[model samples]
Target: MYVQIDLDGPAGTLRVSGHGLPVVELVRAPGSPPDAHTPIGSRRRALLTLRVDGVPASIGPARGRLLRRSYRVDARVGGVRYRLMPCGYEHSALSRDGRRIGTLQSSGDGRVVDEWEGAPDPLDLVLGTALAAAFGTGAAPWWETVGDIVGELIP
Candidate 1:
């Protein structure tokens, strides 16, 4: 399943974090054939608690679920919104595999952050681009259409 999350932070905007502290978003699941590379532990649902720029936002599961090979999540916190989508794929299909959010192309490895350590982070730009693509393509929510000209740093 694809798991995506929008994180609130002092950065002044919505961003994604897998390891900044507190699993603002949890990324894990078991594999078929019981592979040890990935394992499943006792699992249950709990409120998703996060500190957005020091303020806290706890949310109940809203849209996405682990069951879908692909999923999308949109959340609001600290008055800002976050978007997340996770995709599960087979080995053979791994080549050239990526999910498009509007126009920001995300590599399947979930290593999207390091790509934006530089100013005007290309990844973030791409994310906005993805939103624009989706919105313009008429493939996603109408609100995302604003992404075409509006880009934010989440501050």
Candidate 2:
């Protein structure tokens, strides 16, 4: 599985490769204090749009859905890992502190997988997340809508 995580937008996109992947470990940050858990899930916030190999868009993924799961990871990397729940993200494959992570995309039924190259910047996590969201939508980010758009992409 592949995943990318942003601290500010608090958003990300991941593409998984197979079924029964160990996704639970991605949530929360690696080695985070147990008191800080994945924010209670919000369906409105978790709405993910998907496209298969450039197929038409779908609100719910065709193969599977990405779920957010909270977990603790190598503290040297970040201390905690708040990963997608049931599905996986690029963050899982990368060191928590690494910048060149990928995204993990899953189908609703958890069948297929796709991991796209990610572009996260070490300076601004929000900007990096917005960039990723734009990539997912195949649309350019409007200069004015950047903050709100970025905020909407993540929780």
Candidate 3:
């Protein structure tokens, strides 16, 4: 699947579109953590707002630390679970039940690339890109709310 992540904006909004999937827009939630304005905690945060095909949805981190050494965090959008793991050279794998269903890749000159394993949910790709962009900041940071997604849930 073809996905594009746009980060060139003050809002840090991420837009993903392509591959017959619904377009999704992700935005960081307030108090979610690691925002430049906040202090204390890791750069990895789990709260965000996702708009899939113009319908809004919420995604947030689940309690408990990740047991897998390769993965960074576990997040949920409704009942769906998403695991973000590190992959080959600047690439991240977004999986469900240990199966890689999506991926996020970053390149020089500030371009983000993404691909899906099959016909995965568009929101999965959206969440992957949001986390990728958030943690990609690579600077002193803290944990904050990120955001609480609300509105339509893509099926």
Local accuracy by lDDT, each model: 0.29, 0.27, 0.53
Please give, for residues 1-155, the per-residue lDDT of candidate 1 as tens digits.
12244422211123343333322332222231221211111111242233434555532222322233223334345554545443222211111113232223333323232122234333334333222112111122334434533666344
Worst 10 residues of 1 by lDDT: 88-97
For model 3 the local lDDT of residue 131 reads: 58
Task: Please tell me which predicted candidate would have the highest TM-score against the true structure.
Answer: 3
lDDT of 2 by residue, 24-108 (tens): 1112222333221122111222243332223322221112122222221112212322122122232322222344344432222
Candidate order, TM-score descending: 3, 1, 2
Local lDDT at 6 for model 3: 63
Question: What are the TM-scores, per candidate, against the unseen true structure?
Answer: 0.29, 0.21, 0.51
| Candidate scoring better on lDDT of 1 and 2 | 1
Each model's total of backbone clashes: 19, 48, 13
Clashes of 2: 48
Query: Can you rank all candidates by lDDT, best first?
Result: 3, 1, 2
TM-score of 2: 0.21
Q: Comparing candidate 2 with candidate 3, which one achieves the higher TM-score?
A: 3
lDDT of 3 at 30: 54
